[model samples]
Structure formats: C-alpha cells, structure tokens
Target chain A: MPDRVLRLQRIARATAVRAPARRPVMIAIAGDSAAGKTTLSGGLATLLGPGRVTTICVDDYHRYDREERRKLPFTALHPDCNYIGIMEQHLQLLATGEPILKPVYDHRTGQLARPELVCPGDFVIAEGLLPLHTKLARACFDIAVYLDPPEEIRRRWKIDRGVGKRGYDKHQVEAELQRREQESADFIRPQREYADVVVRFAPISEREDPPGTPLSAKLLLRPTIRHPDLSKVLAGDRRWTIHLKLDREENGRPVDALHIHGYAPREDSQEVEKAIWAQLGLEPGDPIHTLGHLANGERSEPLAITQLILLYHMLDESR
Target chain B: MPDRVLRLQRIARATAVRAPARRPVMIAIAGDSAAGKTTLSGGLATLLGPGRVTTICVDDYHRYDREERRKLPFTALHPDCNYIGIMEQHLQLLATGEPILKPVYDHRTGQLARPELVCPGDFVIAEGLLPLHTKLARACFDIAVYLDPPEEIRRRWKIDRGVGKRGYDKHQVEAELQRREQESADFIRPQREYADVVVRFAPISEREDPPGTPLSAKLLLRPTIRHPDLSKVLAGDRRWTIHLKLDREENGRPVDALHIHGYAPREDSQEVEKAIWAQLGLEPGDPIHTLGHLANGERSEPLAITQLILLYHMLDESR
Candidate 1:
C-alpha cells in the first residue's frame, strides 16, 4: 500500500477508537454571516435534545471588534480578520471531547465579550464563516455542511436581522454586504467545496408567487460519505413531492441533487422527515417540527431536512 | 334577488327533498387517450374503497369500433367520432345517481364489447378523453381533472403501454400518435381550460437522473372552486418541500400552481397529504397509498396528491 494510504488507515483506526467511539460527534456548519448557520445548528441541538449538544460560534474568534474591522483593509470574511489558528485548535479539541474557554462576539455592540467555558457533550455543532476554511479544521468534523443561500436572499436576511437585532439600518447592511463581497467570494464560497453537504435556499424562478411563499432548497450531496438510501421514496413513482436528480458533474465527478420543494404539503414534508428518521432508527412521533428555520423563527422545510441529513451522518459516525 | 336566483333557489329546495340529499358524488377525469386517466381514476377508486366508488370509461361512448374508426375521416378525439349526445345524457343521469347501460370498448382487440349495467355507487369517476367536452357534461361533475403530461413523456408511455399490453409494435404506435395529433390538439387540449384541476407530469429538467427517478408534477388549481386552504403549509415558511405559487393569470383570473416535487422525501409528501387531509377533517391514519399511478401499476406522488385533492372535493360535496 502507498505510504499515504497506510497512514490514513492508521489514523482512521485511531480515530475509530479514540474520537467517535469515546467522544462527542462534532459537526462543522460553515457559512457567511446571517447565512443561517445558527438556525441550522440550533435545530440540530434541539433534535438531539437538551444538554446533549453544545454549539460553538467560530465568529467569536474575530481578533478585531466591528469598529476596528471597518478600519482594516480586509473584511471579516478574510482569515486575517479571525484567529484561524486558535479556531482550528479549539475545533480539534471539541472533536476529541475536550473543553475550551471560547470567546464571545456580541454583534449587538460589535465588541468582544467575556470568554465562557464550554464542554463537549454528546454532540458539538461548530458554526460560522471559517469553520471549514483550513484542512486541519475540516479534518476535525465528523460531518460538515455549508449554507449557500443566494446572495440576494442572504442580503435581505442580513438587512432584516441587522435592523431588527443588531441595531443597524438597511443602508449600513447594504454597504457592509458590498464591502464584504470580495472577501466573501474569495474566502467563503470556496469552503463549500470541502463540505459533505451544500445547501442553497432560494425562491423558485419565473413566477410571481404571493409574498411569503416558502423558499425552495437545493442540496448537493457530495460523495465524501454514504447517505441514506432514498430509493423507495424517490424512485419508480412519477409525481414525487421531493425530487432527487443527478446534478451536472463537478470536476468530472457526479453529485446527487435533492430538491425539496417549498410550500410542499405538510404530509409530503412529514413523509420525507419520516423516511430520514427511519434511517436513523428514530421513533416516528418525535416531532421534527423544530428542525428547519432561522433564529428569527421563520421556518424552512429544506433547512430542516438538510440538518436531519447531517445529523444522520453524525449518528452513523458515532455508531 | 333576481328572478333567476329565486327560481334556482326553489329548484334547489325541491331537489334537496327529492334527489342528492343522497346521491353519489361524480368526478370527471378527462384527458387524451394515453394521458393516464385510468391510473388516476383507479387510484381514487381504491382510496375511497372497493364497493363505494364506480368508474365509467367514457371512451365507451365511441360511435364506432376500431375498424370502423379507421374507416372514418375523424380521429377518436374528434367529437364527430364519439356519441357526444349519449355521453352527455349518461353523465347527467350518473350525476343524478341513476343507472345506465354503458358501452365497453376492448382496447386489446380494438372492438366494441357488450354493454354492461353500471349502478351509481356512493362515488362515480368518469374518466376518458372527452368527459368535459360539453357544457352539460361539465355541469354533471362535482370535480373535474385533466391530465396534461408532457408530449414526449406521454409518447414514451404510450409506446411502452402499446407494446406491452395492447400487442402493438413501436411503429404502429408511432403512426397512431401521428394520426391522432391534430384531433387531440383541437379537441383534447381545450378541455384543460374547463377543468378545476390540471395535472402535468414530467422529469425535472437540466439533469440526468437515474432511470427510476420519479417524475415531478405541476398542478394548476383553477379558481373554479374553493380548494383546501394550504396557507399553513405554503405560506409563512420560506423553505417548504411542496410549493404553491400563483400561476400566471388565465383569462385575467388568478390561479394557484401547486408543484409536487418528484422523488421528494416521503416525509415532505406526507406533510402535503396531511395538510390536505386536515383541510378535509380526515383522520391521519386513513391509507392514501393507492391514489397515484396507472392501471399498468406505475405510481406517481403528484398523481396521488392530485387525486387526494379531487377526493377532498368529492367528500366535501357528499357531506
């Protein structure tokens, strides 16, 4: 065997014995600000139940305050704006079930708050812009997800969140979005390639749906890991409520595309949730009502389903 | 009130004392030949249970047998080729819960079989190419549906069914499709505008899915009747699995477009189903597995959902 393969095998064996077998399963949810990382992670934490999951926001690793960030040439999306090395170390620690004094960033005042102690529980959800930016950081996760909402939707969400929660007006949010565009394109989107699953939320095109229609979701499931068999749900029947298609090849490798229709009937959404729950050997009545939505309490069926898929990976790894 | 309103009210009061204060609800499923009418109606019949629903194939109203049809200048889709007057009378009789001696056409041998006595059950499904071709016929239905599968997919299905079941080869089926094109366009397509629901099934575009990937469906719910309130399932949340959008207005009237994603997770489909069921005040455990698919045993989620929607109307009318 090649040296690299032998080394990887040894590491895998070690990891099987030490990490997943004895430690909490760690998931990395990487996305730009207001890209729904908190919502995704919080839902997973809820699904796993209270005290069973711990969440860490890597944006806390920002070395400069928001005001200081304004004076810097680079935006918060850049590696230099964050303590990337320390974030990598903490992620590795959390993956191995260790605790750390995690820093906190208060978006309300754009200041760094006092550090708080965090313990790894049965699961750890690390979410923020830079969680998967480094190879070492990527290696620390049992499962990794990237939230890739459309720029326009993300901007709208950011503006809404900024005004409502962080005391920023629409103009400031718009300016910030423009300022971060270059860094985001350079640093954020590339992380999606490293994720096991990439979720994009957007509206269906070419129609004037009434305002408040749910956003549709497109999930790109990479071949990095095995996903549950949805053949029974997705195959043989025409007129399915959820569509799974083989996406155009990426770098000559095929990927599966799962499109969860927005405004899908509750029964249809429940069917999908049950299929996924069955894969996890979970009971049917556990109430998955909390999985898909933002922190603002806006619900999304695709986000819920996407989070469930990631949870499946974590459970598989732990087992 | 207008004189017509007063007369109609009096007639309604008299009819209530005499007629369908207890009559079978009638549903019309109209489409071109090979448009999946049998599959759709059979599923609904199954859903409503065995002895409760009666199905009538209006193709039985053909004025001529297959050999005789071949001698005529018009195709089966043409009104001149069918017993339109008799069909209208039979539909009216069925709507009023009366029995009729309905004709039978043996699709296998292309011959007219002996007429059979059909009694109106608690529910009657009239499925064929021209059930909604006339205003009187349309009025006889409590609910009307038109299957509008894309031409290419319909063609493939036709060729497959022709070869496998009807004992026709590929070339013959192709020739028949060609022969029927003009009449189908002129007569069959027009019925869609008259339907309360129009269902179209096709593969998701821009991707090559595995052969068994379920076909997605688009349902145009015309505002001819009040549909179940899907507001909870479709509105508020931005990420739904079943999407209901405002269709481009038809004849300056707004309609709702319900798109059921094929290959949707079973959970998502169930959510949709449950929402509709809730609207109908139905218990969640009622089995709905039999609602979608063809007589050939092919299944479609959208078809099932579509049938469920129609069933809702029937149940509503019956109540």
Candidate 2:
C-alpha cells in the first residue's frame, strides 16, 4: 500500500479505538405514570450520597409531558417518540464512568425542565421509564429493579397523592390515569421482565385492609450474575449483616425458606437492624433510636428495614 | 377548578388545532428476537403501495453488532448502545419533509460501517431494537409496533441467523446468548412498552400442534391515538398496494414473512421477488424486491413494509 494509504489506515484505526472510550452508559427508567420508582430511587440516592449517585428520569426525556403521550403514534413505548438513542448513548457514557449533561423533564409542567450535569459517581441510579428496559441502560446498572404495585393500590395511592400533593382532584387524576394507561400498556409494564427484583408495596393475601400505616413492602429478588459463593453473607458476617439477614423459615407451610437478606419473616423481626446501624455508624446501643421515635406511628418495622436494605444495596453497589 | 387557573390554561392553549396538515405516515417496528412485527408490518406496507413506502432500520443505529456488544455494557438493547435519540430527531425531520445522514452498522463485521444520506420518502418505516422507544422517537411515528416472538422460536431464529449470516457456531451462539441475555432482558425486550402492537408468531394451542405451520403470527394492535384503522387499507384503494407473504417456510410453516406495498399485493409481490421495494414514486412494475434479495435468501419484505407503514404514519402525524 502507498504511504498515504498506510497513514490513512493508521488514522482510521486510532479513530476506531478512541470511539469506545468516548461512549458511556445511558440508563432509563420507564414505568407506569405513577409507579413510585422515583420514591425508591430517592432513597437510593440518599444512601449512596448525592455525589455518588446520578439520577436521570426518563420522563424528562419526553418530548411532551404526560398530556402529549396520548396523541402520539405508539405512546411513550415506541422508540421513535422518545429520544431513546440519545438516552442510550448518554448511558454508554455513564457506564464508561464519564460525565454527561442530561436533559430533565419537569413533571410539574410537562416540558424540558433543565439540563443537569451528571458526573460518574460511585453509583449512578437512573430511575425512569425504560431505564433497565433497553440493552444499553441494562449494561450500566450493576443491579436492576422493577416496582410492580397492585393496580388498585397504585390507583388509590395516585388518587390520594394527587389530591394531596399534585393538586389534582379525583376526577382529574382518573382522567390522567386513563391517558397514562395507554402509554403504560404500550411502553411501561413490559420493563418488569428485565428487572433483577420485582418490588410490590401492597400486602399479600389481597386483603382490603386500609392502606397500612406507612407502607407494607414486598420484594421478590431474582439475583442474576452471581459470583463465587460469599458464604460470609450467608453466615451473617458483621459487614454483610448491615445489608443482609440470614434465617430459615417455613415458607408455604411445608417448604423451608432461607434468606441471606436484610428483612425477616417475623413481624417483630430483629431489634438490632444491621443496615440502619451501618449507615448511622452506630453500635447495638446507639442512642439514635430517638430518630426512630421521630417516626411516630407512621412507619412500620418492615418499612424501616426495607429502607435500610435499599440504602445498603445502593452503597454496596457504589463501592 | 379555580377560575383564574382555568382561564390561564385556556389562554395558554394553542388557538387552533389545525388538524396538522396530513403528511406521510411513519410507522416504527420495535421488538425483541423473532417477534413477527416486521412480517405484519410488511403486509400493511404492501397494501399501501410503493409510492408511499420508505424503510429505515433502527438496527442500523447500533454502535456495535453482536461481537462488539460483548465489550460494551448494554449491547444494542441498551439506549446508550444506540444513536436512538438522534435517529428519532431525524425521523421527525423526515416526517416534516427533510433528509438525514443515517449511521449504518455492519452485522457481519460487528462494527459501525458507514453513514448514508436518507431522504424522506412518501411513507417511512423505522424499525429496530429501540424504535418507538423514547419520547423523541415516539413523536416521529404515527403507528408503532412490538414483535414478541416466543422465547423458543426467538432462540432458534437467533441461533440460525447467527450461524447462517453472522458466522457464529452453535456453541458460540449459546455463549452469545449468555452475554446478550442480560442486556436483552434489561433493555431490548422492555421496548414492548412503546409498541402499538405486541405481535407474536407462534401457535396459540400447544395441544392441537398445528402441523401446517407452528408459527401463526399474532399481533396485539395497540393503536395510537390517531392510528389509522386498517379497514381503510382493506377497502380496494389501488392508489397504493403493499404485499405480504410467507417468505420462508420451515417445517411446513412460514418461518419468514415478506411484505410489498403501494400496488396490488399480488401483482406487487410478484414484481419484487428479489428486492424489497421501498422509497417513493415507483412505477407500477418497478422491482421493489431487490433490497431484500441483495444479501441472503432472507426476504427483506418485512423490513420494507415496516418502512412503508412508518412512512404513512409519520406523514399522517405531521399533517
């Protein structure tokens, strides 16, 4: 080959090598209109610390607010309607531990809210529609989760929350729910298959118990990509103790259910919570139970434990 | 219902709902594995006619093919793994009568191959992993689709296609499955959210075991707000005709389906036996099937028709 051709080949090779470094991870969170994924992710950020967590709401990427999804071709589920590729590309950047300026969509007013600067923290928690739903977004997360609430509970939550906070009446909330259902069917619900955990807040047994004070939480963990057995966690190591609880119980009356996780089967549970102790840097006799009293009667032990577990997972993933 | 808030809202609304002048319709086909989305879309496009058909593959948006996906976090299923948002923006421009330089990915090489300038044809079809996935993308299509092929068939199709075209043996294909499954579960399959149609190609009855063809294509048509009723196309409007057929039959069943549009489905299908006829303004007898026949015997009919539907939907939405 001519010298010029050789030079061009070298340049081409260099360019090819450089391209991968330039790309980053783009995580997206796609879910039903009011799935409360944000609430869960919020706790994650708190645990990881804001500096270590970069949160991107896929809703912000919406060209139109919740109102506009109704008139679109495929609802928000279709890639054509959303800047999916851009989000994907951004995610690639994040996965590579790079910084990005992500577009923000304001939920309060359905519009491009702001452009937030996102630097790769120890952990990047992207919560929105389709975050874990795409191949690109999935690659970025060390762990992925889905929040699936009972429809009735979700609706009731939406109604109460809407009236209380979002400034919408029951009728208006219902209308919004109908509109959102179209998009949810087309774009949100399918993301469940991609989650490592499917989290449901409603109580089991389908009882119509008035929404429990605080919230009752249930998480079905489907751990993928397991590494060499960390018997330490199963053995209840102190460090692992913060995030996990190990125990054996009767599951379906006959089957034995064993856990190496933070929550427990008993309502009384353990008086000493590892996750809480780990975060607060407290020992068994820490005086911070005063903070516990701050909870008044609004929170349940499971809820508190669940929060601690979420926090531990976030910090652990970051580390 | 505060009068001031209501009055402000009315004032903020656009004065006229202009029915946005009817433009070409654009349809996006998005799905996972062997979802029969492409096949169903082909039939619709064939009925529509070539003068209004244009096909653009969102698969082309992949930054890397199967091989390169291994080194990446999310593979093509991740939003960051694609140039999706840009693609959506381009589609939007095309729907409004513009052109774009689209990036191409070489499946055989597993690399970014080239970029080609694509003009907006009469009708546009954009299909791929994340098409109709994001808000920006969803805006570009008037119709959106998701193909949900059964896992067994999807795996088989992926295996055969990988072995046949992409140069992967069975073992390597299995390994690829292990690698790609994470991203696929996380991102690629979740795109079902944004689809107007969740299409599956398989037998509904396991016991009957239809001998003719195990794969009976099924589509869950989740029509958009303005999704056109196919009843219009069923009526004999010969202005444009799209043709769809079983392109490849396996075990007495159609393994591959094809679509030709903008003429008589029967006549047009015959004319383009080798090429997938897309783009606009074709003579009645033009060979539209060449696009599909260029590579393997694999019919590009599904791809072509998807483009046509997308084109129609895009134009229609633009109006």
Candidate 3:
C-alpha cells in the first residue's frame, strides 16, 4: 500500500515537472513481445531525422535475463520479472527532457549488458513490453500507444524472430509463449485501455490476401487527448485506402477508428503524409519518406500511415 | 555543463524532500576497493537494529561487468566506468526516503546480476568507491565519511580478499591495483575533501604492536558539520584509550582529530560509546556492542568508537 501511494505521488510529480522549455515529447509504444513495437518506434525515429528522436526499450529493465528467467515460475511478461520501478523512474526523468543512464538487457545473448546514457532529444520514443504497464509509467508520456496484433500473427512473428535470429528453437519459443499467455492476458493486454492509440497491425481478415500481402492497421484513437484531424487530409483515398469511422467504446463513448488498408499506394499515402506534415507548420518536402521500412526489407503502407498519424500527435503536442 | 547543472537542481530537490515523518538519515562511506566498506556498513546496520537500517553499496551501479572492464583502458574506480548519472539519481531518490529498484553488480562472479528493491528505513548507509565522487551525490547524505587507509595496508587487504575469496590470484590482484592507482588518486582520493569526516585505520606508527594487534583509527572531524563534544566525554579515559586533540588543516584551519588506540580495552571504549549514545537521547544499554567486528572473527575497539561517533551525527541530524 505504501508503494502504491508512493507511486501515486510520483505520478503527480512526474506530471508537474514540465518546466523545461524544450522538453521532449514523450511517446510510449507498449505491447507484448513481438508486437511490432520496435518496428513502429524505429520508423518514427527515422521519420524524425537524425538525433531528433531517442528510442528506449523498457525491456532493458528486466529483473532477470533470458537464462535466469527460465528458472522462474513466471515469464518476463509478469510484472514481477522486471524492474518496473526503475523503468518508471527513467521514464519520469526522460519525460522532463532530462537524461538517464538506462540499464541494458541483451536479448540475443541472454545477458545483462552495460548500461548507457540516454539524453532526451526533441522527441523520445520508449517502446517495450511494459512501458504502459503501470499508471505511474503511463503518466510520464505525452502520448501512449499499444500494439494489439492478433494472437496468431504475433505468435508467428515471435517464432520467426526467436528461431531465425535469437538462437531459440521453435519448440522453446512455443513453450515460452504458452507460459506467457496468462501473464500477457492479465498484464500486457490490459494496458491497451490506458493508451491513447491502440494499433492493431494484421492482415485484413475478410480479404483473400496472398502470403506476401502487406498487413493493414486498425488504429483506435481515444479521446483522452486531442488527435489529429486525419479525416480532413484523408478524405480522398482515391481507392478507399484510408477511412475514419466513429466507433463506440466499451463505455458507450464515441471513439475514432482510423483504418489504413494494406494496399494503400505509396503515392496516395505520400499525399496524406504530406498533408499531415504541413499541419506541423513545416514544409512538407518528403518529411516522412522513411516511415515504414520493415526488417525484411519490405514496405507496409499501413505502417507508414500509422507512424505519420503518431508523428502528427507528437508535433501537435509540441505546439 | 548541463548534466552538472541538472544534477545540482536535483540535489536541491533531494535535500528539500524532508517532509516525511520518518525520513531515513543517509550516510555515505566511500573509499577504494577492499577498503572495509562492506564490513563497516554491516557493523553499522547491526548496531542500528534489525530492519531499522538499509545498507547500499553504490558499486552496484557499475556500467560494465568485470569481463568487459578488463578490455577498457580505465578501471572500475574511474567515474566513466560506472553509471555516475544513475547513481546520483538513485541516491537522490533513496535520500528522500523513497524506494528504488537498484542495479546489482556481483563482485564475486564479475557479472551484472538482478536488481533488488531498496526501501529506506530509519537509516540508509551507502558505501562504495564513488558515493562521494560527485558534489551532487555527496549533497544527498546527512553524514559523509571517507575511509583512508595507508597504501601498503590497503594493498595487502585487497590482495588478501581478492585471492582468498574472489578467485583472483595475487599477481592478478596486484596488477589490477596497479592499473587502478592512477584513477584512485585522480577520482577516488579527491572525494576525501568532500567528506565531513575522514577515517584512517592503521597501526599506531612507531608503536611496538604485534601482528595480532587490531588497527587503531584516526578520525579527522572537519567543521563542515558539527562534531560531538568528545572532549567532554573523554574527560577521564582511564588509560588514555581515547583522546581529543586540536588539529590543523592544510590551510591552517582548526580541525578536530580524535584518535582511538587499538590497544584500548573493550570496557574503556564502551564508556565512550555510552557517552555518545546518551547524547542521542537514548538509554545507553548495549546499544553499540556489535560494532567493529572484522571479517576474520576479530573485534576492534577503535572501530566501535568510530561507528558510535558517526551514529551520533546521524541521530542528531534526525532530531
């Protein structure tokens, strides 16, 4: 109970420490592992140009590394398995446009690596499994996002990354995922409600898309904060590529659901991107050309559009 | 310059957060490696009673594990080799009677281990190589102590601990100490100037003491903070076990140097302890009997007296 109260007080202090004249616009992209958080964060950082954005992985605050975690009863998804307090403290520091010496966890080698000094830039993007896990952490962000990929799709992505890159076998990956299911459901998924934007990147279920087709993004923009007038710029999709519809929330409140189709043409998305960039009070000369490059050297127009929408919030908040 | 200024501001915040009804009194015991830091800190914790004190070794904030450090040009004593920024921040947090998820650097295995939650109790003793290395960090403590051992004794102590317990050969320990000497002089020794009390434990020079004789202590009580009225307490030292002398600082400023002899019997030292404990407004029972227990199962009367003086300062600040 004391910890809870202490955290509450710290949250108040975190919100109150906005005195820095050029504080970073803090953004959180929180999701379960393999939920496209890194991809989205990287795209945004690239879009903002060199040194304009500092990206942090809250997973670095893991209480245990991969090897030691195997001995634990719970997976990393459990809040107990991570240093949530340190993550919250670092978030509070960075949100105030201050610096932090953040811990490092090496996912590939399953070891805790050396820490690094992180100085906030014009924008700070914090992405990890639990950036929005606690209210204290979420309170430190100017905008919070949650990735909500379909379970099946996220499983496939995890297996591919775990086996192809992280030196884990398919069975181990599957078993770990199974062990984490309850935790993810209990802890990770619940954070979506706290996010201002919930992004689900998956193939359109109704479409008979081929294996190589790009994934679409469904973004639920909550009214907890003001969002971009995306409808104004996205009125002409030419092919019904981008559309916004008024959706009802769980509490019967009207929310905005902006869908960007997988097959959005580069030219059409660029038109919309240019419009959003111009809204930032800057010249829209290819401002966000590098918004959606996937690790496998593929392009996803939906990812680009989603990033631009987030970028719009980032710039809008700074104004 | 910005980091220094930021640290300064946070230091102010740290000191200003004394509104808690039971804020922990912070004390720092800083010195080079194998400087009896853990031993001193453990004794202080024991004397303070169970659960009433929290001991923190700031060395846990090491930026790199021992293996990685071997490849670096500087030793762990170098400020850059540790997370000085995070250490300062965590000190600020803990000094404010707040909880912190502190990182762990395992000296035994030379690996970065899992962090632990530290909740400040009635007393917080932070002992490490660099707790007083920065002015900002030093400002968080109510009482600051620097352990200054003669080079020969410190070397022997390090080699003994390193080779016997930490799995290092004598040659390796000596080589590492040689590599660290420059950094120790440049970074570690300079912190002594920032301390309110400097403690030097060594054999009484020119005395015909045997090898088994416990080391005596010479405490330079700088006027940066008020010192207990030891002259009053030592009006009758029986056999001159404890004495207070007017000392001169480098700039001819008057300082107090209290010297306690190793040959002082336990009974005489207890008298001094009783006097100091009475000053704390507590009943002088066996309040400080557990102090000065060395690692080799031996006890030192001088150590007991040193800890009692420090406790006087800590309790006085709380009052």
Candidate 4:
C-alpha cells in the first residue's frame, strides 16, 4: 500500500477503537425565568446542526405543575419544587452518553407534558434554573454558563413574554415578578458565581438613544476554563468597539470582562464572528444567522455573538 | 542619497508641510472623586513617555475653596461650583496645542494653591469629574472616557482615600459622599453618556473570594469612533477567559463589550497586551510595569489593562 493509504488506515483503525468510548460534550445554561436561556440554546442547536445536538430544559424536572406550584408558598426557583434527584440522574446519564426518558414542562400552558425519549448526541445543552446549583449536576457538564439580564431589562422581557405568549396580563405578570423576586434573589442569582461564564443583556444607561436600538452585553468571563485568545483580532484598531479588560473584583476575586458594541459596524462584527467560527474548526460561511436572533425573529447581534461564544466552549470540549 | 533615505527625506518633507496644522491628541478621563482618574491618567503618561504627554485635572477649575463651599448648598459636582467658562476655554486651547496658566486645587488643604504654566504636548490626558459634561469640553477631546465605578465601590474607595491620603475621618468622608450624591447624579454621571468609553470597576458579586483578589472591569466602548479588530486574538480558544461580545443595547443602540480575566495566566494577558502594543506600533518589551500599579503601590491587572486600552486610543490618534 502507498504510505498515505497506510497512514489513513492506521488512523481509521485508531478512531474506530476509540469511537465507542467517546462521550458527548455537555453544557449547562443556568438562569432565572425569561433570562433568554431558550433563545440562547436554540441558536447553538441550529449552529451545531440538527440531529447533532440535544437540548434539555431542566424546568421540566419540576415536581409540581403551575397549579400545584401556585398552591405552595415557595416559588418554582426553590430546589424543593423540582425533582432534584431525577434531574441529577438524567444529567449524569446524558453526560455519560446514555439515553434517558426526559420529562417536559410546557411553559405556555404551565403543565406537565409527556416524557420524551432522548439519546445523547454529539452535544447536549441543558438550560434552566438550578442546573448548576448542585455539585453532581455541575460535574455532569463540561461547561456552565449563567444568563444574567439586568432586573429592569429582565422584568421588561418577562412582562412582554408573559403577556404576549404565556396568557399572563400586565398586572398578573407584575405580581408574579414581585412574588418571584425573593426567590430569584435567594436562589437563581446565586448560580451566577458557579458559572464559568455569566452573560448579561442590559440597556446602555445614561444615554437617550431611541428604543429598538440593539441592546449591549457585558460578559464576565471567569478563569475556570481555558478561553480563546482574541488579541490578534483586536490588534488592528485601538478603538473600544470590541476589547478586553481584567475584571475589577467579583466575589472578592478578579475576573475578566469582555464588551462588544451593538453598533459595531457589520464588517467588524463579521470579522469577529468569522474568527469564532474558525475556532470551532468550522467553515467561515457556516450558518450563524440563527445565533443572534430574538424570539420575534428580529436578529440581535449581541445574542448571536453570545451564543457563538458558548458554542465555542462546547466544540472546544469535544475536541 | 540612497533610494531609501531619499524616500524618507521626501516623506519627511511632506510631513513637515502637514506638521504645523496637526493638532495634539486630546483624551478626557472624567469621573467622580476617587474614581481612580489620576491613577489612570498617570499610567498613560508613563506609557506614552512623560515628555510627549501632558496631564491636566479639570478639578482645578473649582471656583471656591473647601471651607467656602461648605456654606453653599451646591457641591463641587455642580457646574455652578466651577469656572465652567474658563475650563471650556482652557480645553479649547489645549486641544489646539496651546498653553494656559491653569489653576490648581490642593485636595489635601482644600484650597486653590497656585496658577501654573501649562503647555500641551503631543498627547494630553485631562481627567476629572465632568470633562464630558459640556458640549464644548466634549468637543475638545479626540477620545473621552468616563470612569463609573459602582456607587458602593466608589463610596468605599472615597472613604479609604479620604482617610488614608486626604486626612478625613470615616464620618467626614461619609458626610461628603452623602452631600455630593445629588450633584453627582445630576451632573457627573450624566456625562457618561457622552463618553466614547465608560469604565467601571466592580467586585465580583455573590461569592466572597478574598480582599486581595484582583478586580474586574467593564468597559462600554461606544461606537463613536472606529475601533480595533480583535477577532483573531480570541479566535483560538473559544474559552471565556478573554473574549468580546456585542452589547445588547446602549442608549437604544448596539455597542461592543471586551472582557479580560485577571486570574488568567500571565501568558494569556501578555498576548492581549502585546497585541495592543503592536496596534500602537510600540516596540515589544517597552516599559508597561508602571501601567497597572495603584496609588498604594499594589498592582491591579485590570487597571493596567484598562490603561493599556486607553493608551492604544491615544497612540492611534497620534498616528
């Protein structure tokens, strides 16, 4: 045989030997209600290609339905409101590339749906509150992220999502927010510290720019894992449109902060997007259109970029 | 002459024709008291080389002494408390590379000590509260940055600086912060919207890491100017440690966010620093040791990186 053919056969034999033992990469996206967790994960799913990615929402692990939850004094954010043991076991299964019958919670109807059979794909993205709240749950994932939109912005998003799609009226949504505020503070927000990355979507303060302007994002990139280097991409201009700085202090420790301008020229953003796509070892023109999109179908460049970064983590872990 | 030397001579001749008309690059660093404005400016001065840079403090424009100000209902943050007209004129002069006899404010004694000769250099960094508060002052700067440390963190920093350096007790410092709160809100903070960059130093929330842990920084880089491309630098790892994202919304517009991890390995930060230095066209291994050190002599990696980004702006403008 030719040397090249022999080399290829040797590599194929080695891959075949290792293929059965390789586990799928697991990612956890932990956040409060209406924190855009679904939007984020859906983008990643589209980017990774259907059938290659499996997504699970841990909200399905709730032991109580809406009516049942309403009867209790505790909010859905409480750990006791969830089937913590089952969720933990399923996560472990997914981490190990095992199949599981996963429960489903229909947010629109606030009811428990039929369990669905899920086989671990090349990638698994588990998003919802409390995913990173437990040690075992956290250990099951190769990467953990927390979506942390500002309260005011999040409240606005929740009100819109609740009233528009979830059958909640303005007054009802406000009351729910007020009721859940304590639980969110007590339980949900605390998960941020456990995350390797915290993504926040907030309005630019102090400016009177008109509405419909894309929202800005502040990413707190903790050093819990190895991150990509962006220095070369930013080497050309010294302007602040996109840049990196060390985080001041968080939980008494120093972290890194990454800022991206919503108004950055399309070309600049494209360069960044292409770079990130390349990091995934994917082609430059791969479909990223779904990455920064909003529920209304309007594209949010920031959201897309945020999802791309998370996708990088998942792909990196698989490598 | 040799062809290379002849080409250089021709270029030098072309440059001389444009030299007299070129204006010095002006950078404004505006922030409330103890916002680390001086430290930030000082770092830039060292990086750009002292002889090529001039540092100005607009706080010198205070029209009243400390005791005299005590009798008034207004705080120094109020425009009425300052020589707004003179500050405007001086800014214009400095922007045009002219000189002024600038007034001085002695924070230690709470007095106007002297009026000194001030000459603008190739690079001028004006740091103080309210530099971007007025349209004319804003117009004078090639780059404008507003330091926006969190109120809680700022209060703590003010108390420390006031007690340790300015000879004020805890109660006295607290009283000053309380007294100035309204004016700071009304005047100083509003200037942030006009800045090209808004820098905030904050501790990691939620967990209690340790006191000595490095702080994280969030820099809101507005799209007022063209910025550098950093996609290549971040293209490799896909890790969250150092990365950039498009901001969700700022003033109803999109912005870019850059995050750097303080806990990142030295090699990682060095890559960023080297990239920025290359953008500035500076030689590698140039002195940056003095960049991130604080007033107390302890170094903060975040502060240093922040200073470096600002330096890139200055050097870019000068080029």
Cα lDDT tens digits for candidate 3, A1-319: 2432354346434534654435788899999999999888888888786588899999888888888898899988889998886787778778766678777888778777656778889888999889988656776788899999999999999999999988889999999899889999999999998999999998877777776778888999999888876657766644467888889988898899988778666778767666667776667566566877887788877888888889888888766
* Candidate 2 whole-model C-alpha lDDT, 0 to 1: 0.53
TM-score of 1: 0.46
Error of 4 at A246 (Å): 0.8
Backbone clash tally for model 1? 49
Q: Number of clashes in model 4?
A: 69
Model 4, span B132-164: residue lDDT tens? 877667777888998988888889889999999
Best by DockQ: 3
| DockQ values, each candidate | 0.00, 0.01, 0.19, 0.00
lDDT of each: 0.77, 0.53, 0.81, 0.77
**TM-score, chain B, predicted structure 4:** 0.89
RMSD after CA superposition, every candidate: 31.6, 23.7, 5.7, 31.0
Per-model i-RMS: 39.4, 21.2, 11.4, 34.1
List the candidate 2 regions with Cα displacement exceeding 4 Å: A1-30, A65-79, A206-212, A227-272, A275-300, A315-319, B1-319
Q: Tell me, by lDDT, which candidate is best.
A: 3
The CAPRI class of candidate 1 is incorrect
Hey, what RMSD does candidate 1 come out at? 31.6
What lDDT does candidate 3 reach at residue A141? 81
Q: lDDT for model 4, on a 0 to 1 scale? A: 0.77
